[model samples]
Target: MKKYIIILSSVIIIIALGGIYMKHQYDERQEKNKTAESELYEKAKKRMTDYINANYEGIDKINFSNNYKMDQMGGINAEGYLNGDKSKEFWGIYDKSNNIITSSYVDAKEKPACKEKPCKY
Candidate 1:
């Protein structure tokens, strides 16, 4: 009976350790995924910024939404405000081709606009 009890306890300890290790591994994977996602977003933002700078020029104080629409054809659509004015909204579209991200932007017609200065980007 004593030998059986020792065996059972040892098995339980082994199972607990295994569970802990598995949990640690799962946590590490999640962290890695989050880091990768952050990096991707930064790169996308950079592409969008380049597009804005090349076309718009002389734009100050811009804000972009954290959430963007993604399509299966490797396109991403993003929305943002210009010159800290919510009414002055715009949309940017990014396409990925051959590992290169290209971007374009347009004024948001659906959203209402204000006659604010320094809001054209």
Candidate 2:
């Protein structure tokens, strides 16, 4: 009976340790995802700002939306609307791997352009 009790106790302790380890790993993963999201958001925001500033002179407060889509591979797609003309909007894709604007296109037509200014999306 004593031997059985010792084995049971060991099993319980191991299970507890495993649970704690799993929880810690999950938390770490979540933190990493959050960090990545924020980084992507900032990059997308900048892409929009640069586009508006270049396309239209003296346009400071163009409407910018947070990253609308985030891929597991750290790719992001977002849209920005011209402040003066809400109907005019552009979208851009940010590739986190190279930390650069992969593509941009206007809403009216999907013209993929590599230019950083005048976002192509």
Best by TM-score: 2
- Model 2: residues >4 Å from true position, as ranges? 84-86, 97-99, 107-121
Find the 10 residues in a row with the least total lDDT in model 1. Answer: 109-118
TM-score of each: 0.67, 0.67
Best-performing candidate as measured by lDDT: 2
lDDT of 1: 0.64
Clashing pairs in 2: 91-121, 104-120, 104-121, 105-120, 105-121
**Candidate 2 C-alpha RMSD relative to the actual structure:** 4.9
lDDT of 1 by residue, 24-106 (tens): 99999999977765666666666666555545534675688888776677566666877788887767666655333444444
**lDDT per residue as tens, model 2, 37-112:** 8877887778656654544444445676654888777788878776557787777777777766676755443223
Worst 10 residues of 2 by lDDT: 108-117
